[model samples]
Target: MNLSKYLLIGLGVLSLHSCDDFLGNKPKGYTIPEKFEDYSKLLNSSYLMSSSNTVLAYLTDDLYRTSRGEIMNENAEGKLIEYTEFNFSGCDDHERNLYTFKHGQVLTAGNSDPLWNNAYENIYVYNAVANNILNVPDATKEQREAKYAEALVGRAFEYLNLVNIFGNHYDPKTAGTDYGVPILLSEVVGDGASYVRNTVAEVYDQIISDLKTATPLLPEVATNVYHPSQTIGYAFQARMFLYMGDYENALKNANEALKLNDELLDMKPYTTTYSTFGRIVLESNPDETFPEDVDNVENIFMRNLNGAGSGFYTAVVASEDLLETFKRHLAPDGVDMRLRLFFATDEANFTMNPSATPEKFKGYSTYAPYITQNAGFTTPEIYLIAAECEARIGSVSRALQLLDQLRDARIKNNVHYVEETDAPNRTEALRLVIDERRREFAMQGAPRLIDLKRLNREDWFRKDIVHSADGETWTLPANDLRYIMPIPQTVLDFNPDMPQYDR
Candidate 1:
């Protein structure tokens, strides 16, 4: 297959004017797909498998921004030149706006948010397959149904991210009335067509409906992680149900997904001593040791962080709070494979710049130069989901057992890893599970922000977030309206009548 041809097809469908302009635009240079093979090729396109809303990581507490003045030095010419310190110097205005929770300021009318645009663009690909695959000539019933199921699951994954990022946290009381993202199911959009936002409840309902309809039609395991399988379908259901506070279904689906694939990557083998650092470090290069996102045993479904030009995945370092979490969760032997493998604190090895100062190494550097940060479903996430839901609806011991299983895999030289058994109540058990989630998934995706939004519903779990940069501090109070991100000004400009969030 000519991958470039499909790339052009995907790019041709994108329009800079607006959501409608992009969705309505047809492929100009390629032949319109008319057969099952062509549609299958569309589904198989690498463009649809990768890319996710990576900026969502900025809104979380996992990262801290460095001020320009902190990293700049005066040269012989008396001009200030910025030095790279773990790439934090590359943090841009949009990232700063998100980091500081500057509402209505992250984007301007002419500027487009990659999170919003990439999601909708991928949705167009999925919709194209879902809406027309059955009608394609020269395909068997099973093949058509299977391809259609894959598209539905793919589309649901995109909508799940869109609704969570743009809509408010799900509330049974207000979800039906709260505005969610616009739902576009048709493959082709009419000229000048406009779409009204769907309610949060309606959006969730559609997601659940699609997953339910697609699960049985999908294979037990996908040919690869890029394609959605029955396992991925169940995993997504588990995730969606957890967000909705339906612990029963969350636990049920988590178990179902785990039954299909529960393999976790053991991090101990990836650890080694670097002569330059004089201490343990993860493999100097991940490509040699760590599996690519598509081949990772832990991945149930693969969607990589769209880190190109976005520093969130590669440039951003761990915040003090996140570093503290790693320290707090270290095994009795003072070994946490996650911290050692995913982060670097040795200034010389971390930054690879001799000029880097000790002050610059206050926060650990993210060692993700080659390892792709997956924002999609993974086996360990399933374990965490099962643990959390079990803590809420089942025995606390059962929850700890599940949590211990995952920790044992990640921690080095662990005998049993049953440290959480002392919890006297379900509340303590749930707290442990939540902390484990932060440690395991820190700086990866939108999980932390989503956790904060949902857990704020409970008074016990509710807490404020404080971020400091350039001698100024901003606090986002629990349940603050700013938890919901504002729609990009470009999006609103395109559809003047579209309802916008007040945040």
Candidate 2:
């Protein structure tokens, strides 16, 4: 076996002919092994392919550190500038000022652009891996099942993200009438051709179908707490159902994920010193061993990172809005350890431009080093989902109990606790739950859009003015049409069968 070929096969592009050529270059640079029995190699490739752009995504995306002149200025100068000027406006301000981001641009096909190209290219890789696994005949029943499960989960994850941004949420009752991202599971390649888009309902149906089949087949084996599991699949189902307004199934599936992994990282025993608390949350070391020490108990699913290289993840500092909210809720006496663990503010202030006044960023970073991909399936989220679902079902007491349980984990043996009375009854409880979720998961980018959808605040957020650390307010007007990204124009060009999303 050639180590070079093995590494390249998993990481680099050997064939660039077209996406249709999944098995690029005849498996070049290595002698074929007597038996294609290396399931581990295939697994490694799956993980790598999923994580290939982990760092890039964080560096450039709005969910992380602002790519504007202040935070990332020293590192990614020009790229950050373009991102700040274009993507930032597109994402944060609803594409009002973007000169190039026309609704027609996204609706049309055969547009040779980077954004669409990259999305489809990544989908191509997932398709290639799935296709290869399907063709591997020597795989045992167990191996085949595992491979298929991974493929199903991977494709589902990709499609869900794409549809949410490119299309709209699934409304099964009216799915056929809605437009959705193109449903492409195969690795086909061609130039510009006519195509049309599917409805959001069709997209959700496919996602549910894939996950339903995959969850049962996934093994009970747990390699790392961060990686996907049967429970994670259930969590995704709960989340999807919640988005679909199916509260009953949402509650059921979220509870199922919690039952599988409900333990939270207790802050009580380790809160003697502020520095110690800081270590628990912010410090990342190569080998500061403490015997696991109950650190990641609440992590249901995580992405794994092995090195500090290009493809690995990075920390995205928090926005000022999130930081200020935490500060406002901080106990005047300093009893709230979560505030300390989650954020840090430097006394030194700097101005981006000379004419502008200096101000502190009050930036926040992750307390713990988790895998990238800018998202995780955590116990806290499960608890939050449970609270939301329960509240919807008139179980306010049960819902608040779940919320308090998570809140209790963050506060040390205190002088204080979240008063159950303050949490509100059923109707108001729904709003409180949404507020708690926004505060707790700030900048981690979990289901804020869903809350917006539920409250009919989608139009509101898309139109409201959001400010940064420097107090620059970015505004998105009502139903500006950029709330949903355009389907990559190229996708419409090549696939004549695909439908275009309306502007």
Candidate 3:
């Protein structure tokens, strides 16, 4: 039979009650899924496995937009033709608006936000499996339980991303009233479906509940990285607690995840001395140097940025601040394995117009036939969460030890790697953990922007982010309402009663 047709029909049926018009169209085929295998196919679909929220990267401080003078082209005569009127290079209007924190209409009224759309679309698939898997005719009890568990975990993952982007940071005092994205647990969308926003606390409560319920049902390790396991369940719990500022639970869950799989990918093997650049550079082909998500031992769960090859991973340059973080943490021999493996100067790998000076730009390296930048749970992330929690409530020495352990793997040859002898006070240790988090997760996903939101809760961590273009500057002050992204205009237009965050 035709599997693709059935897949489309299954998804189309699931989307019948979709809140937005994007998924309203009925498919041409009318086949309804009846076999256990049909529901299994829906869960294992590539659309569910590979979906991502890449647009959130534009709202972070990790990227830099090149100035007008830097965006140049050359004629046949080899003379440079600069676009004096253009403000930034290699970025479109939407990216420019997000990068500069424009006050109004970052996304046009009729347009959809991929971050919002991809998330809810994937949610529908998860809800389908979660709501109906047990009743499927031929599945064994164990098999049905496992699929249901996976769906719950997947739905929790999407809700976590949504709430973090669209809602206020989880302030225990205010979260009860703070608006979060709508919570839809069932696949049954009807014409009268309610699309009102849930409170931040309510949404987080649902995430925690889903994870707790799924933990026992999950296997110790998943069959593949795209599927959730007991380890990922714990890892996601740790992430949820970290965002909520619950240190004890975060550390407990983080350690639980690490106990299962704490391996970090050693980067030394991926580097080589290049005579052309007179320094160590990453192996230009990432397919050889970097393992695919399924094969990567570091990943507990894997969700890639959509169109990773052509989107944020390759198109934009690293901000000067982010590059400086790498520079400051360089080993005595001026080598950082992460810097070599993940970032490259324009001279090393030019991605802009030829006439632009190659020496002036540095972007996240995308030397590959395909790119898979994981935005999900990983061992290092858990280690960092554990370390940060230790710094906050447990032990400074333990925090330093964890940081040093991760650093030992990333720093070249362990040249300047020293054990934790002179431990800083708790405040300084926490600062170090926060800094290391930035270095590790720069431009990977929405971590930096989310970090800004959560960290701003403390007086010491509160700081303004400034962005400049075309001789104009925008400063997003700590705890600014802009940190909470407004509801997508299309979402608002469709659900008129839906409240939007004030910018």
**lDDT (tens digit, per residue) of candidate 3 on 228-334:** 88898889999999999999999999998888889987666665332222123346652354565887788889887675654454456677777777776455675
Instruction: Per model, state how many residue pairs clash.
Output: 0, 17, 1
Candidate 1 pairs with clashing backbones = none
Tens-digit per-residue lDDT, 194-220, candidate 1: 668898998898898888889889987
TM-score of each: 0.86, 0.68, 0.86
Candidate numbers, best lDDT first, in rank order: 1, 3, 2
- In order, candidate lDDTs are 0.73, 0.50, 0.71
Sort the candidates on TM-score, descending order: 1, 3, 2
**Model 3: clashing residue pairs?**
17-189
- The candidate 3 region of ten consecutive residues with least summed lDDT is 1-10
Position 386, candidate 3: lDDT:
97
Better of 2 and 3 by lDDT: 3
lDDT top scorer: 1
Candidate 1 CA-lDDT value: 0.73
Candidate 2, 1-503: lDDT as tens digits: 22221111112232222312233345532322222244334444533333222221221112333444544332234443221321232232222222223445532232343333444444554454555664566867776676667667766766676666566555666567867776666544322223346678877888898898889877775456534578878788887887788989989999898878788766544421122212332234412322231246766655432222221212334444445545443355544455454333331112224344322333334323222322446777888889989988948888878877876776644333243655456755665576567666543332454344345544322333243333344443343444555554344334445555555
